[model samples]
Target: MIHPAQSLRTFIGSKNFEESTRFYQTLGFEVKKINPGFSLVKVSGNLCFYLQDYYQKDWCENCMLFLEVEQLDAYWEAVKILGLPEKFKGVKLSEIKKDDWGREFFLHDPAGNLWHFGEFFD
Candidate 1:
């Protein structure tokens, strides 16, 4: 017997491609292609996010994307250069404590989508 395959890709709805592209780029994602009213962002390994224009008031109400990284400090520093919300104030770089599971951080996209950056140390 064979187990079911894991997720192949995640397609998300977006009303603003330009803003969404910028947001993902800030998180280290590279654009794979751009078509009419749609854009593809490469997140990792076989994971890709396809953003398409849609008519919805709350598209990300129950959606969240988590990215796994190797180094939290370096990734955080790079994101800092891209600018973050003031809520992150007083959060020292070294103070980025790691939980029992791993190191992580939260961020909001321009379209009000919540994202989590997680790091697994072995």
Candidate 2:
């Protein structure tokens, strides 16, 4: 039988593929280059996505994903190690906060894709 779903990765767009690749690299995602227009970025063992070169206004604007990390605080701190907030001017992020469901935070990549991070309470 085929395996059930385990994880997910979203393919989002980038106006400038090279710059976007660098942005994700700074976010601590390992990248495997396919071409000038495409790359596969592994966020973790089971999470990865294809970064494709595309710039249709509506499509890029509509792209978004919820990324589930094991630890929100550590993830944010490691990302901060890259100084990505300084690296990307006017970058956006949300503070870590917990609700009934889980603790979570958010950040926006250069391609304008919104990534929300969350995990269940211990």
Candidate 3:
């Protein structure tokens, strides 16, 4: 039997390093700079990823992340109130939609990376 891993981290690419960092911070994620070109972003203690000041159009556009939240409706409301789409170029937000598995809202970052904020049915 395989043992469970302690933690897992994904590397995310950013087109404009400063803007991307600011974007994540604006979304309420904690960001800790590692160096000039790389940083760490955390939504919670156990959930985090590496944000790199690097970009490949194909990779950035195709990348997607699904983040499970406790209260998706409230989260969506907060996101809407932020007016991210108006503040950041290329940012887009979608209404909450229900599917077989759960309900979710969509957000596309400035780099065109898609994020699904969802809540699974209990």
List CA RMSD, all candidates.
4.7, 2.3, 0.9
Q: Write one digit per residue (lDDT tens) for candidate 3, span 1-122.
A: 99998778999899999999989999999999999989999999879999999999999999999999988999999999988999899999999999999999999998889999999988
RMSD of 3: 0.9
Candidate 1 per-residue C-alpha lDDT over 19-45 given as tens digits, one digit per residue, 9 for 90 to 100: 666666756788766787677877776
Name the regions of candidate 3 deviating beyond 4 angstroms.
none
Q: Which ten-residue region of model 1 has the weakest summed lDDT? A: 86-95
Q: Residue 106 of model 1: what lDDT?
A: 71
The CA lDDT at 9 in model 1 is 65
Supply the global lDDT for candidate 3: 0.93
Ranking by lDDT: 3, 2, 1
- Residue 94, candidate 3: how far off, in angstroms? 0.4
Off by over 4 Å in 2: 1-9
Best by lDDT: 3
Candidate number that wins on TM-score, 1 or 2: 2
